[model samples]
Each structure stands twice: as C-alpha cells, then as structure tokens.
Target: MIVLDYPYVSRFLTDSVLELGQAVLDTPQARRLAGDAPLHYIDEIEFSARLALGGKVYTNSENGLGHVLRCRCNEDLARQIDICKDKALFRESVAALHPDYRFRRVPFEDLAGLDAPDVDYPFIIKPTRGFFSLGVHVVNTPADWPAAVRAIEAERAALNAEYPEAVVSGGEFIIEQSIDGEEYAIDVYFDAEGNPVITNILHHTFLSADDVSDRLYYTSARIIETWLLPFTDYLRDVARECGFRDFVSHIEVRVTETGDIIPIEANPLRLAGWCVADITALAWGFNPYECYFKELRPDWDAILTENQGMATAMVIGDLPSSLDRTRIRDVDYEGFQSLFANILELRKIDYHQYPVFAFAFVSLPETELPALKQTVSQDFTRFVVTE
Candidate 1:
C-alpha cells in the first residue's frame, strides 16, 4: 500500500504535487499513499481532478510511516539512502568519498559545558535531523554560544509544536566550523540501471553572511548545460562511494571562490518539500516526479536532444519566527516585481498569519542575473513576507 504523507502534501507546490500523483497512476502496481483497499484522500482534489484527468483511484491502505518506502522505492534502497538524513552520518559518508571533502562534526552534548572552550568564530550548530533550517545557529564568537543555545532551545519548542510526532533529541548535533562561499544544491536521479544523473544545480541565496535560513534557490536549463561534466562525474563517484543506488536525492554543496564543489548535506528521495524537484521540469520539460515514475529511469539523451533553453524555479524561504512569535504583516510586492521582472508565477504557500514559504518560477536572461541576486538579497521582503 502506498501512503502519501499528508497534511504533508498540503505543504508543497500543488501543481507539482498533482504531477507526482499522476506519476503514481502511471506506475504499474502503485497506489495512493493514504488508502486502505480503494479509499484514500488525494488532498484538496483527488476526486475532481482525477476524474477530469482520467486518473485512477487506488484505495489499498498502508499503515505506519515506516512503510513510506513502499510508496515508491525498495526497502533496502530506502534505508541505505536514508542514513544520509542524519547530518553527522552524512558528513562521514561524504568525507569517506574523498579526503579533500572535509567537514568537522561534534555532538551538542560536548558543547553544553560552560568550561570547555575556544571554538573558532563562525561555527554552525544544527539538529542532527533538522528540517527547514529550524534550530540552526551561527556562533560568531565565544560570547555567542549562550545566545545561540537559547535560540536553539526556542526553535526546538516551536518545532515540537509544529511536528510533535518527530521530536528533536537534544543529545546529538553536528557542530561544524562554518565555511565561506556561495552555496548550491544538486538534484540527483539514478536510472533504473544505477547511473546517477545530476538533473539540476540550484544557486542559493541567503539573507546575510551568518544567515543559515534557506532563503532562495533557483536553477535554469541553460545553466545546467554550461556546467563542467566533471562535477556530475564527481557526484556519481560520491553516490557510488556512499553505497547508494537507484535513488533520488538532493545534495547540498558549497562552491568556493576557486570553483571547487563541496558537498555538505544530503536529502534522500528527492529535494526538501515545496517541490524543489519541479525545477527539473522548469529546467527540462518533465517535472522530476513525472520523470521518476513515468520513465522510471530518466531519458537524458532525449531530453538533452530537445536542447531546452532558459527557465528557472525560485523557492523563497519562510520568515523566521520572531522571539515574540509574531506573524508576517507586510511584503514589498512592487519591489519584488521591480527586482525580478521575469517571474512567471509568484505566491505565498500560506498566509502571513500561517507563515510558510513562498516561491516563483521564471526565465530571466543571463544579463540580469548579477543584479537579480544582489537586489533580491538586499531587499529581503521584496518577494517574501517579513514578521
């Protein structure tokens, strides 16, 4: 039984989410992630749209979140790839791939003491199982640890309120000396034959030098075409080195000034929600979801043969919760359009009161990119809400 994690689906790009559901319909022996023998919800609109699109409704039920692998992957493969979810394990696994790729990790328990000291300036502390950048902090100096820990404590409480089922254990964390550089993410797909394909490389935007909150990410088809082949080849090596096969993953990396790619975080079975994977569709013609099941293994030869041009997907980060827990009350809309004129679609996922992420998809010519990046970061509320 396939069980689409819910209320969870409500948290993503609905267009791409529906495309994913359609892929399930295309896959043989697949069913919705929420049914029990022909009765399951398709969230917002499985009944109407399914009927309109001539989609099938499968009601076979599956219980327990542990069965998530049954939704689209084999059990062994899922477990193998999931280890990367633990940020600590992820660092070891990636560093194992090559000595040059290095990340220092320390348990949070080690830092809880008052006397143990002298950590370098500009370090990061994040939950071992963090999501959406919650409980992530930057320690700019020795004096910042107290406030940083307090912030993590507050974030832990807010996260517990948002997701009670999966609590963040305070015992473990990966504290790393921060690295400098522009950050990026690569969406990976393995063909049914185990060949890894780098479908998209996202250019990320941050609020400031110490800002760990994930703000914006964008990628274009034309940009992907210009990337060096060795980068993808290196990713394939990382996959093989880590013992992952036949999987979909979003690998986060930092590109240093010298242009070396450094892999930092790994999320298995697709990019983090909000349909970041849909950028693949915005980049190439097919959304990553449709490509995954409909093709099972993507047909890169045919896709590249089409020689698609410029297109981009933008994912804007949610406003960070205030210390007082305030809601967003304002947005700079005119500033947004003026800064990024190529926006095709722009909207907030949740209202200012609810405070979720916002996104846009567009295709801007190369000439405007430098200004786009600088202006967007400088004007924080231009496209997103501010608390």
Candidate 2:
C-alpha cells in the first residue's frame, strides 16, 4: 500500500503505483492530485487492517507520515518512524555504532542560552525533525553561532506554519559534530528477513562547505558500483541495530577519508523525497517504487554494462529567497532548461504553493560532470520575473 500526500508527487510515481496495482490510501489530497487517474483506492479501515496483517506501507513524502501514523496498526513501524524522524533520537539510537560521535539536543527555546565559548567548532545544527535542508546550518567558528542562531530563529518563524511538526518541527534542535568525507543518499528497503535491498544511490553534491541547499543530486553506475556492496553491508548492520524489517528508507551517509561509512540520518518508509528516486528509472530503466512492492533487485552487472559512463541528475529549481514570491509573474523555465544539455523530465511546481519552482532531471555523461556543478551555482533569481 502507498500513501500519497503533499508537497509534490511525480507522474512517474503515480503511474508506477497504478502499474504495480498498489492501493493508494483514499484521501482528498490523493483524489484531487490524481484526478481521473484510475488509482485503486483503499479506505482507512481496510488500510489499517492490512497494517495489522503486516502489510508493507510506503509513503512518498514525510507529510504523509502523520496520516500513516494515525492509521498504522503496527507499533514497530511507528517506532521505526520515531527513531528516523527525530534527528536527535536517531543519533542516540545509532550512537553505539559510532561511540566516539559527539552530539547534544537542545530545546528550541533554549537555543539562545547555548554557550558558544564552551562549544566545539565545526558542527551541524538543525531541527530535530527536519525535511530537506530547512533550518540546517554549519557552524565553523564561535563567530558563526550568533548568525546560525538568528537564521534558526528566522527559519523557526517562517517554517512553523509551512509544514507539519511531523515533517519539520521547531520544538527542538540537535547539535552534532560534523562527519568528514563525501556524502551520498541511498534508497533502500529492509526485506521481511531484514536484509537490505538498495535500489538507488545518489551522490549529494554541494558547491561549497556551507552550501546545505538541496539543489542537486545525481546517480550513475560508477557511484553504485563503488558504494553498493559496502553500503549494503552498513545498512544491514543498521537494520539489525534498529530492528527494522519490511521497511523502506532514504538514508544519507558520509564516507570518510579512511573509508568508514557514517550515517547522517535515515528517512523511513520512502525513497528520496519528491520523487528524486525516479533518477533510478531514468538511469537504469527500472521503477524504484515497483522494486519495493514487487521485491525486485536490478542485476547490477548487467545494468552497469548497459549504462556505463552515464549520469542522471535531479536538480531542484528553488526560488531565490530574496525574491518576493507573492509578486511573481512568470518563471523562465525555457531559459533554465537551456542550461542543461539534455533534460529527461521537468516537473514544474506551483511556486505560490511551494518554495521551489521545479524539479528537473537531466542525463549527462561522466565527462560532463563540470556542467552539473556549474548548474548548481547558477543564480535562480535570473529566471524569475517579478511584478
């Protein structure tokens, strides 16, 4: 069973759900978004009953988590969500895995009272329950704390009404020591026996050290080939540690200089939020959603042979923060797409309803990686025409 809710659902996901004959939980939002799409609707009662019978449930967005938590009959599943959603709790849960890791959880009201003099430099501070990169900031020095606090305050006020507490809570924040190395995001599920099944692996790239925006993510056969086996092993350990079974997660991790894999956080019961997982389909010719429902794994050797040296990317077209969205008249999507050599799909979002303008998927060769890097650094304000 799949539960669909805001902020965005890709056409690829909706079609895949229908193609796999998965029942979408009947909700007004689902109905409205999937108009005339012939989706199999399952009422709350039946869905809850299926949950009691250990039926697997996958949610596309964390916004759908509230509904799933209310309807779910499995306490274990709820527990898993609790651990993954709360960044502080997630850190504590996995602390045994990395005993040397340092972290502290602070209440939202107590943020101002935090003593910067005693604090360690080069740490990350973010809402305990956060989605995307909202409220995430890196404090590299004592001087950065005041600015970070101010940013968090602004974010607290701006985001409180924008998302559900289940999605982005402002009640508490976590301060953790930064992990060094290359970051990657994975879409994987723990099967009935608790074995990890990795469906997609994306290298989360950033232009600079302080750039925490979710502007770009891409995947290629080379990325999968290098990290698949090690990540699978690490996730296996994580699943066992967390007591996870028949659960899906979008996990972020940093592979250290010494080749140690340290988890950042695990987003439970979904692939990458906002259908970024579709890059798997665009790159490897398989549906990520269907892979979980049907228990299918791609033959990596064969897939790599077919998709050598190709990179598929998901670029977020975020509106410039300084631009007044309320006064926006038009978005130059054509000019934006002109930046890319080959766009596989462009999913334009309603900027009036959401902060982003679109989610673009592009296909690139390994030699063209510089283009992806260059695209992320582009100023999005140039694409907006405000009244």
Candidate 3:
C-alpha cells in the first residue's frame, strides 16, 4: 500500500505503480498529483484493511504520515514511524549502538536560553522533526548560537504554513554533536524477518562543513561496492535494535575515519523526496519501487561488474533563501543544464510554490567526481529571471 502526498510526485513512480499494480491510497492530493493516470486506487477502508493484514506500507512524503497513523494497521508500523520521525526518540532507541554520541532535545522557546558554556562546541541544531534541511544549522562557537536561533525564528512562521507540523515542526529542536566523516544517503527496506535489503546508495557531497543544502547526491559502482555490505550490516543492527520489519526508509549516515557508520536520521516510508529515487533507475537498470514491492534484491556482484566506471547523481537546483520566490519570473533550465556534463533527466519544479527550480539526474564518468563538486558551488542566481 502507498500514500502519495503534497509537494511532488514523478512520472517514474506513476509508471512503477502501473507496472507493479500497486494500490495507491485514494486521496484528493493523490488524485490531483497523479492526475487521471490509471493507477489502482483504494479507498480508506481497503487501505486500512491491507495495512492491518501486515501489507507493506510506503509513503513518498512525511506529510502522508498522518494518514498512515490514522490507519492504525500494525502497532509496530506506528512505533517505527514515531521512532524514526522523532530525532530524540530515534537517538535513544539506537543509543546502545553509539553510546558515546552526545545529544539533547531542547524546546524551541528555550533554544535561546541554552547556556553556551554547557554545550559541546560545534554541534548541530535542527528541528526535532524536520524535512529538506530547513532550520538546520551548525553552531561552531558561542557567537554562532544567536544566528542559528534567529534563523530558526525567521523561518518558523513560513515553515509552519508551508508544511504540516507532522512533516516539519518548530516546537522542538535537537542539539547533537556533529559526526566527522564522509556522508551517504541510502534507500533500503527491512524484510518480514527484519533483514535489511539494500537498494541504492548515494554519496552526499557538500562544499563546506557548515553547508546544509540538498545540492548533490551521486552514486557509482565503486560506492556500492565499498559501502553496500557495511551499510547493510548497520541497517541490520538498526532493525534489530528498533524491531523494524516490512519498513522502508531513506537514511543518512556518516562513515567515521575509523570506518564506523553512525546514523544521522531516517526519513520514513520513502526514498528521496521529490522522486529523487528515480536516480536509481537512471543509474541502474531497475525501478526502486519494484525492487521494494517485489522484494527483488539487486545482485550486487553482477551489477558492480557490469557498471564499473559510470556514476549517477541527483543535483538539486534550490533557490537561495535570499531570493524572493514571489518575484521570480522564470528559470533558464537550459542555461543551468549547460553546467553539467551529461543530464539523464531534468525535472523542472514550480519555484513560485516551492523553493527549488528543478532536480537534475546526471550520468557522469567516475573520474569527473570533482566536476560534480564544482557544480554544487556554482552561483545558480544567474539562471533565474526576476521582475
């Protein structure tokens, strides 16, 4: 069973639904986003019935989490969602895995009052429940604390109005010590027996330590060959500790210098947002949706051998916060694509309603990794036309 919610959906997903014959929960939002596509639509009753029967559940956006909660299908399903969505709870559940990791949850009202001397230097502060990296800031020193608080305050109202509190809330914020290492975002689902089945792994690249934007995520045969086994082992530990089964999650983690995989957080019931999961299809020759629904695990050994030198990436064209979205006239998508070497697909988004201009899936030579990094730091304002 799948629940589609606001923001965006993709042609790849709809095609997957048609191909897999997956039942989408019939909601107005789903109908509108999905259009008149001949998808198998199920009513609320059937949705709940299927869920109660222990059918697999997946949601494209956390906004649809409310519908999943209301269905009350499986107790563990609800529990798993709660634990994954709440950063504090998620930290506690997996504390045994990283006993030395430091973290604390502070109410939004008290964020400004936190004693600077008491906090560990250079920690990350973000909404307890957040999506898309909004309100995420790295406080390197006491002087940076005020700026982080003000930034959160500035975005609070817009955040509340733009996203449901379930998807993103400013009620509470989490302060945790930053993990130092290479970061990666993974898409995986646990089977009925709580064994994790890995689907795709993308290396998340950032220009600087303090940069927190959905700028670039790329994967290659080398990445999969290197981290697939270790990440699967890490997920198994997470599943065992959290009692997760028949659950799908898009998880972010950091691999330390010592080769330890420390989880950042898990976005429940989906791969990447705005159908970035399609990067899997662009990179590999399979649909991630089909992989999950049919429990079709990738033959990693064969896959790695076949695609040894190629790399795939999802590059987000996010509008800078300084730009006034309402005044934007148009985006020169062609101008932006000129920056990349090869674009597999260019998904243009309505920046007037959303902050992003588009999501580009690109195929590049693994040797051109530095070019991908350079593309992330380019001044995207040149591509926008403002009144």
What is the TM-score of each predicted model, taking all chains together?
0.73, 0.98, 0.98
Residues 276-338 of candidate 2 have per-residue lDDT tens digits of 888888889988888898888878899899989999998999975666789989999999888
Report clash pairs, candidate 3. none
Off by over 4 Å in 2: 117-119
User: What is the alpha-carbon lDDT for the whole of candidate 2?
Assistant: 0.88
The number of clashing residue pairs in model 3 is 0
What's the alpha carbon RMSD for model 2? 1.2
lDDT of 1 by residue, 247-357 (tens): 666778777778766777777665545455655665666655555444444566676656554546474635546512254555555555555667766655543333454
RMSD (Å) of each candidate, 1 decimal? 7.2, 1.2, 1.1
Candidate 1 residue spans exceeding 4 A from truth: 1-3, 6-75, 100-110, 114-121, 164-171, 294-317, 323-339, 352-354, 378-387
The better candidate by lDDT, 1 or 3, is 3
> Global CA lDDT of candidate 3, please?
0.89
Q: Cα deviation in Å at residue 166, candidate 1?
A: 4.2
